[model samples]
Target: MATPKSAVYAASKHAVLGFSNALRMELAPIGIHLTTVNLGPVNTNFFDNADPSGKYRQSVRRYMLDPHKVAQKNCKKPL
Candidate 1:
């Protein structure tokens, strides 16, 4: 169980994504619009890199993603 201490943050995003995916499938007959942004790494600093040892720093940094690109692609209004 790879549980992160702050999983709710990831869960909220996943919930919205899951809802949209299912909703889109359900509403396809009616010509409604939807998109699910299944995203990967973006260049930003959300992870801690304070370790003096470069090994841990490098490993830890992989978890983060750039908010700018995520916002640009994912900021659907009327949520």
Candidate 2:
């Protein structure tokens, strides 16, 4: 989902995924675990700043995830 203006953001996400995968392998033998949650945009005030015009937010509102629900699901899951 790399949009036209989000090259740096996309690259940073990829970098995090790469780093986490490497770290997970390195820590597995010691019983340490890591989890990466790659999710689409959530319904939040972030859109107020990121999309001041409200067009993107309006377009994606129906598809946006509930932040609380997302956190609850992730927190309750076994790592």
The lDDT for every candidate, in the order shown, is: 0.61, 0.87
Question: Candidate 1 on 1-79: residue-level lDDT in tens?
Answer: 1134447757887788889989999999999989776555344443343333445436655664666756766567622
- Top-TM-score structure, candidate number: 2
Q: What TM-score against the true fold does each predicted structure earn?
A: 0.48, 0.69
Task: Specify the poorest-scoring 10-residue window by lDDT in model 2.
Answer: 70-79
Which segments of model 2 are wrong by more than 4 Å? 74-79
* Superposed Cα deviation of residue 47, candidate 1 (Å): 2.1
lDDT of 2 at 62: 85
Query: For model 1, what is the alpha-carbon lDDT of residue 23?
Result: 98
Candidate 2: tens digits of C-alpha lDDT, residues 6-65: 688889999999999999999999999999989898999988987688888888888999
| Cand. 2 Cα-lDDT | 0.87
Q: What does the lDDT come to for candidate 1? A: 0.61
